[model samples]
Target: MKEISCALRFMFSAEFWAMGLCWTVSLLASYWQLVLRRITGRCEVYPRSELPRNLPTRPVCIVTGATSGLGAAAASALSKEGFSVVLVGLSSELLSEAMEEIRKRNKDAHLKGFVVDLSSFCSILEFKSSLEKWLTDSDMHSSIQLLINNAGILATSVRPTPEGYDQMMGTNYIGAFFLTKLLLPLLKTSPVGSRIVNVTSFTHRAVFDAQINEDIVTGKCFFRSKEYPYARVYQYSKLCLLLFTYELHRQLNLDNKPWQVSVLAADPGMVKTNIMQEVPFSLSNIAYLVFRVLGLLQSPENGINSILDAALAPSHVSGAYFFGGEGRTLRSSALSYNTRLGEKLWNISSNMFFDLKLASQATSSSS
Candidate 1:
């Protein structure tokens, strides 16, 4: 009875209306830009070639969230390009499905699948250890050429990751940051022009300065489902990702020992994905109507064009944000470049993972 009463009260409260209004405005602002691009005929689709390459050696492309949606699309496309694509998903079964999907597109697709739950620190560390051993065993002939941090979620519930952080923030930003940091040494050994593409969104602009804090990661800010602003939380996660993208890009080129690797961000503006399914039926239904009515949602293939360009286009510069196709680029939110906020976020996030490094070592030794 109490739970029901609380839900009912929240549904009728001013907070609920305020949240809806904010989401509606953000959605319009973000999608309208894409709509204008489409109207101006600036969005052109990238084509794929199916021929398998017989090169002496191939570079590896690691794409997370490979089981479905844009991630799976990216994995398949990279495989077609003759890169030895390493597909990362949350489970072995999902990885198998992704590999199978890729092979269906190109029977000769060079692909490998690995399971790494981004929301779990132990899982990430274990996967890193396994990948390191694999690279060593394989004689280091094929180093990672590209990494796409594509796995993300828009969580409506107050679910905590295995590491007790907000699941969305953990998966969308921290997990990507951790995985990229762990792989930096390997990436340094990669081909001279290796690249890292951290996927971000325009929705990041929705998060204001005051909302950017450690509480976002500590899970205190989004602890209650009834009052949780799902759309804003999604924006918060993307904002953190954009900040990481900028800081990492800056750090990589710092101190005169510039890494050959290029770090960039891609915004696939309003793609159709399973992320919205987690929202309540009322909200999801409204979003669906808006998507259909405004022609705002795009297919995974159409959406990944920006991502593919970021990954494959040699002309791209590091720290650039690919906002749309046809070589379009845009400055991300002004707040995304706030160096102080970026440094603070970097320190906190790095410390969070560093704090877990000891625990991970202990657990592995025990096992």
Candidate 2:
């Protein structure tokens, strides 16, 4: 009877409670640092006078998915900084609304809108042509200074694009890849040098499969069935973007060009955006709600802060992955640094684009 009483006392002892408290505190700290703080969005504001003055007097900054959210916020901010901003989106109405909001912030803002569905490679090609013509007509071909690949989508299911690739993969990574490649000429010609900021996500570390990556880029993979998780697909798309950023940076170095064109991946953390609108009543939704209530989700303005930093980064800042409101450079996933995987992915993507161009040409000739 005495032993039993002693055991019970030990179970409820101060030492036991102290140990438990320590564990709880440690867990909460880890969660806050790794998950919450990373996504909560923080920013350090630089006064207008401190803005990078090395750029052209009327530098050009192109922002994709600028109809709303981080892209819109970035466009408004850049315009206020005296950049001639080009807004890209899928809807003319949304583009006009975004432009109006930006102009309201900076009435002298030089903003132009282009409506192009990024989910479609053909549309990106059309946009590229139209953008080049506009640049030439405006005599601003040499003024291109920044490209923000901010457009992305989250799919609840695997829908195939018109080009027969997964919708999320096509829009988030492949389209951005092609668009940047197509605009390389203007970017390389920039007098103030250029920067390409690919808006990635921390989710890239969540789901990364090399085989799956190859399959998605080669158009041999589809998740239309319920077997694959749509959230994983989104993570994979971001992983592809990170890989592309690193690979592009490496290629730029290999080309040995004196003109600086830095490519960087920016993880915006967990911004309150429409990207997750497709997520149903899942654990993700629950977590999002908790984050919102806790005020851990970042605003669009705070979310794009890293992207702005990457865009204005110095020449030596190429190929780095930046995060949070601080815009501190951090090591990405192990796979992100795998040179072999990056090279393979780059080759596969280039081949896929080549095939797409050939197919388009064939269709046009047949027509």
Candidate 3:
């Protein structure tokens, strides 16, 4: 009887109660932000008409995956800020719809839609060519003030791209890497200092024990045969993104160019988005449902603030990881800070791009 009573006391200890209280308060806060504020339309930083206008003076911001969810929200906010916003996505129809939706809120908003499938390196290169052509046609060599690498996928099954690489890794990390590399000239030439915001996630912390090489090189680590869950694969991809961000920052500083470019990683808190649609009826789904019931999911508007914060931060804050809406710089995983690992990943990705380019050239010659 005494043992049972002692166990009960321990279970109800002050530390446990305090932890429970903190979690409850966090849930309530999330609910208020996601539900009440969103419904009231009070979540936006600027209303239509109040957003800045006049593209010549305003900065230009390029946002990938801007057709939906947090990407759309961030693009809209940037439009409000009077930036010449470029929305890049896979669907022309969705891009049109997204631009129209932003214009509905701010009729004077300057927005352009460009369709590019981030999962394909060739598609990204094509996008770069199209962008250059458009700029040339417009007689505009304007520096891009901000580039937001936000396109990503959460695949339930292991699907490799035509390049024989994991779809998730290709889209989430390599695509962004190649795109950023291709656009480095534009970013460097911007009249004002440039910023690159890579949208990462807190789930990257889950990759502490992951085999990074297998995941990035062959996608074997994420195979169903290995029993590695889809969620973990997504997390691993984000981990690679964070590493890329750090490495890019290092390279930018090394270049010592007059036009400064800052690289930042942003972790948007879990937001209500269609990203979860790919998850089947599994423990992941059950956990998501539990989070929803507990009011732990954030609104898309709130989720994007961290990204915006990173994009608008001062140049000195480069190589920093910002968290949630607060936009506070936080330490990422220890692996993320490993310079050797980052360099290795960079070399491997560069080699992959080189191999793809070689293959394309060979095929063209043969044809």
Candidate 4:
């Protein structure tokens, strides 16, 4: 009884909680510092200024996962830069709040919200059609200067969407792929070279450990239990996303299209985002607490710099991978850059999207 009491006391004590929180924040801070140092050859948050005085006028940007965290920050930043910002997410309440915040920051800014549940591909398709129609109907048609795929989901157990693809892949890869494809025409309608930014992470390197077996892609792989760690599943999804980004860049370059559509990949240096809340267990709670205590960590605003830099940097060209913030080019994992891996991911995603379309059609016909 005494031991149990002591353990409970320790767990609940302010000192223990404070220490854990401090450590988590410090770890994330240190991680970001290291990344900035490597990419810029210096240690500091990617130093940036407000949008340049001579920047283009009335650029439009559509950003996913914008209700919170990196996505919201990116949209807010763009709003300040004089762009019409579209915030995408499923939460109507959050979307309203985000819109209000951006509105406050940019009084003349046109802020739109698309309530999208990215976990379902059908929902994404619905969003795509709605977005296209909305764009076409508005004066802002053909004004989209950038599309940022910043929204993501993390799940611990093996989960499948209604479309049969793994949940992580469905939200992170297939949804993103189809969204980009659907929006390509709108993106091309831009005045000049526009940008498409896909937010990825260093966690993608872990793909070497948990290789994507075919069974996993086919939904034949079962979740061992609900006890699986979310970080692992999240990393797998990012690995596939990074690979897909590389392949998409290659295809864009191969096509030699006249329009300047820059396909870029970026990672938000570690920040305190509630992304961990989706983890299956209580450890995620602990992790969040720890990160909150670390003063070394960045605010979401800091994390968005990389995505914004990649999107708006004047010098950036197509087919580049950028580390977020300062927007410098990054050397990704060798496997991510591997043509074979990228091709495999592309093939898998294409097939999955095809099936999703077929399934939707069959269901619609039956209904």
Residue-by-residue lDDT tens digits, candidate 4, 1-367: 6645645654665544543444344345436655677777754232333443342556778899999889988888888777778899879999999888878877877888989877687788788778777777875545567889988876535677776667776677667888887678777767666778899876665555545555554433545443433455566677777877878888877666733676878877566677755432355455555545644456787877778777776623655666645556666667778888788777876776777789888998999
TM-score winner between 2 and 4, please give it: 2
The candidate 2 region of ten consecutive residues with least summed lDDT is 42-51
lDDT of 4 at 170: 69
What tens digits encode model 3's per-residue C-alpha lDDT throughout 124-201? 888888887877766665567789999998875688776667888888988898899888889888765788999997
Q: Give the alpha-carbon lDDT of every model.
A: 0.76, 0.75, 0.75, 0.70
Per-structure clash totals for the candidates: 0, 1, 1, 5
Can you write out model 1's per-residue Cα lDDT over 186-225, one digit (the tens) per residue?
A: 7777655578999888778777773556777656667755
Q: What's the TM for model 4?
A: 0.80
Worst 10 residues of 1 by lDDT: 46-55
All candidates in order of lDDT, best leading: 1, 3, 2, 4
Give me the candidate number with maximum lDDT: 1
Task: Give TM per candidate.
Answer: 0.85, 0.82, 0.80, 0.80
User: How do the residues 1-367 of candidate 2 rate in per-residue lDDT, one tens digit apiece?
Assistant: 6645644654455533443344234324423554544476532222112335665357888999999999999999888877889999989999999998887778899999999888787898888888888887887645478899999997756678888788788889898988887788888878666789999977676544555356766334665353444555667788888888998998998877733788988877777777766543343455567667856577898988778777666655688777655446566778878888888888888888888888888988999
TM-score of model 1 (CA atoms): 0.85
In angstroms, the error of model 3 at 48 is: 20
Per-residue lDDT, model 1, residue 157, is 67
lDDT at 323 for candidate 2? Answer: 68
